[model samples]
Target: MQLFAFGLNHQTAPLAVREQVAFNVDGIENALRDLVENGAAKEATILSTCNRMELYCNAAKPEHAIDWLAEYHKLPRQELEPYLYTLPRDLAVKHSFRVASGLDSMVLGEPQILGQMKQAVRQAEQAGTMGILLHKLFQNTFSVAKQVRTETEIGANLVSMAAAAVRLAERIFPSIEEQNVLFIGAGEMIELNAVYFAARNPKRITVANRTLERAQTLARQYNGHAITLSDLPEQLAQNDIIVTCTASQLPILGKGMVERALKARRHKPLFIVDLAVPRDVETEVSELNDVFLYTVDDIAEVVKDGLEARQGAVKEAEVIIESGVSDFLHWMESRDVVPTIRALRENAEHSRRQELEKAVRLLAKGESPEKVLEAMSRGLTNKFLHAPTHALNQAHGKDRDNFLDVARRLHHLHNDE
Candidate 1:
């Protein structure tokens, strides 16, 4: 099977296109099963994060897997083809290593992508779609990531999306300590943002989710309060900063909701960061007066400031990743030879067993042990050499010379004379 990876990421596609093909946590298992059961791939792993949606697969033809993505997402193939990147074999292996090492992330050396990848692998495994190739690929991928993290300073001076959100909020307001912070959703991104925002010791932090129990769980971690989504209307105006990242397909906060909140706050400037892909806050909410709204893409500029400092670490990380890629590819090549090695050993064992059985029968029939042993040895040697000797005899000129060299090397013989 051939290894391949194809997808669109933060660099290749904007949030609009990326969100269109994003996979939900609940749908991943079915999607992976569909990819493998329908013959698009022998094994597959779908890594769908806020910034990217990549399918790493083992297939004879990548087109089938690519087509499956478009069809699965119900998008026109032509519309999505322009932004998609397809990497095959070595390129795929290299890309997987780099991605896991944080080399391919928008925020240079952010470590969140590595955890996101681990979650994707777990999903694939639970779906029962993970096979030998992808299993080995991710195993190597994780090892490379760990090596890069330990050997290089790639994660140094990193600016995560959560950190960027906090930075942006600080720019708008003097100090987060004086402002009440509102975090929507209890997902990984929201949890991380909560941690960063909590570090500033926001006056009052509130986690609002569809489920109060889940929101309460995250809220307690930061010594914050928890509320249901229904509480946003009454509680929205109370907070000066809001960071939202939810899986809701529809907008959680609309323009009217924010307008009312603004009126309640008496036109006090409110800072909002929408970290969701489809967007928890409506796009029209940005047009509201006295509101500073930022999306995930809007944080890109803030994330770039530390890029120059980490440039040197990138080179070091790449060196480690390259070494890892070479090792993984070598392992893959060795796996390819397993069948041949097994067959060769099996063939030799069969020949030896046949000769041993004949020798045993001769001894049982009262033949001398020395003679039987000699005959068996002769028979085994002939059986082992027959193929090579026949090929050598049939060879002529250049072919014969090449065959003779192969034989000499096979037997470790030297023409010292």
Candidate 2:
């Protein structure tokens, strides 16, 4: 199987296209199964995040996988093809290593992509589409990611999405330490945002989720409060800052909800960061006079800092990634030889057994031991040389030249004996 990774990311596609093709947590399993079922991929793992929607696959043909992604998403292949980048063999391996290392992220050197990749692998495994190639790719990806993180200062000064949300809130409140911060959902992104905001020792931290029990569990870690989604309308007006990231297919906060909150607060500025891919906050909420809204894409400019300083580290990362890619491709190449190698060994063994039997019969029929041994050696040698010698004699034209050269090289090498 050939290794490949193809898709669009923050650098290649705008938020509109990215969101259109983005898969939520619920969609990953089906997408992976569909990829294999449709003959697009022999094995597949799709990584869908706020900034990227990539497919890492092992397949007989890369074209089939690319067409599958576009068709499966109902996107025009021509339109998506411009943004899509198909990396084959070594390049694909390098991309996987770099992506896992966070060198490919919009905000370079962010650790979250590693976790996102792990989640993708888990989903692929659950879907029963993760075969040896993908399994090894993911395993090597994790090792490379850990090496990059530990060996380089790539992750230093991490002004990630969670951190950027906190920065935007601090801009609104002057000091986040005095304001109440609310985090919606108990998912990984929300938990990360909660950790960042809670670091400021906010007046109070509240986690609101569809499940009150889940919210309470996450909230208790920060000495905070919890509430169900139903409590938002009653409790919304109380918070000064809100950060939300959920996998919901629909908007969690619409114009009606925020407008009501604004009136309840009598025009107090509310800082809201919607980190979800499809977006938890309604688009109209951005138009509100008192609401400050940002998204995963909006914070892209903020978290993208120290490009020049990190350039040195990025270059270092590229070198490591190249080494890793070459190694992985070498391993894949070796795997390709296994069946042929096994076949050749079996053929040799069959010839040896046939010759051995002939030698035993000659000895049993009262042939001299010395004569039997000599005959046995000659028989095995003749058997080994027979097929290739015959093929070389029969070969003609292009096959003649090639087999003649091959036979000459083999004879010369063993003729030394």
Candidate 3:
């Protein structure tokens, strides 16, 4: 099967396009089943993050998969063509290796993409869309990622999104120690941001999640209290800084809600960072007076602050990925020849069985043992050589010479004759 990886990312597509195509974690299983059920691919796995939405699949035609992506997102093919990138065979293998290695991230050498990829694999498995091809691809992907991380200095001085969020908060407020920090959602991003902000020993930390138990679990780690999404209205105006990232399909913090918060605080400047894909805070929230709002796309610029030091690591990382790609492609090539190998073995077995049966009948008829064994050996030899001899006789000029060379190599013949 032809392996392909196709989609758009932070490099090929802008945040506007990325968000439009981003898959909700809750809906990925159905999307994967749609891909296989619709004949778009034989095997598929989707990697959707705040920065990228890539679909890797085993298919005969990569174009079919690309069309599936456009149709699934309800976008015209022409609109997505400009931002889409399709990598076939070896290129797809290399791209998968690079992505899992963090060489393709908006934040250089970030570790979060690897976890996101693992989640994608799990979702595909649950959907029953992950076949042997994808299973082997991901297994190699995780191995290569581990090698890249362990063998190189790629992750050194990494500027993670969490760290960037804290840096942005620092810019707005003189001292994190003096500001009250409110974090929305208890997911990985929120947990990470909580860790960074907690380091500064903020005045108070509050985690608001869809489930209070999850929020409470994360809150207990930092000696903070937990609240549900419903508490936002009464508690919103009390915090000086808010960093929100949740899986909610709709915006959790609306313009009117924040406007009331601003009025309650008497127009004190409020810093807000919305790291969710659909965005927990409304876009209109940015238009409010005395409010500084940053989304995942907005933080891309901030994350680039220390990227120069990591450039050297990127070259090293690419070399590791190249080695990985070569190994994986070799494995795929071996798999491709499986049918040929099985057919060859089956043909040989049939010839041997036919010759043995004749020899057994001759021995049962009381023929000389030596004579029967000699005849069977001759029959087996003739059967093995017949096909090659016939082909050689039929060949002309270059074809004849090429067949002769292959026959010689197959039989381990010397050129002395």
Candidate 3 lDDT (Cα, whole model)? 0.91
All candidates in order of lDDT, best leading = 1, 3, 2
Top candidate, metric lDDT: 1
Candidate 2 stretches with Cα past 4 Å from truth are 357-373, 391-417
lDDT of 3 by residue, 1-417 (tens): 878998888889877778788899999999999999999899999998888899999887778888888898899999999998989888988999999999999898999999999999999999998998899999999999999999888888898999998898899889999999999998898888888999999999999988999999999999999999999999999999999988787899999999999999999999998888877888899999999999888888888877888888888888888988888888999999999999999999999999999999999999999999999999999999898889999999999999989989988999985
Q: TM-score of every model? A: 0.95, 0.91, 0.96
Candidate with the larger lDDT of 1 and 3: 1
Q: List the residue pairs that clash in candidate 3.
A: none
**lDDT tens per residue, model 1, 118-188:** 99999999999898999999999999999999988888888899889988988898988999999999999
Higher-TM-score candidate among 1 and 2? 1
User: Which portions of model 3 show Cα errors greater than 4 Å?
Assistant: none
* Residue 255 shift from truth in candidate 3, angstroms: 1.2
RMSD of each: 1.8, 2.6, 1.5
Candidates in descending TM-score order: 3, 1, 2
Tens digits of per-residue lDDT, candidate 2, 19-52, equal 7788878889998898899988899999999889
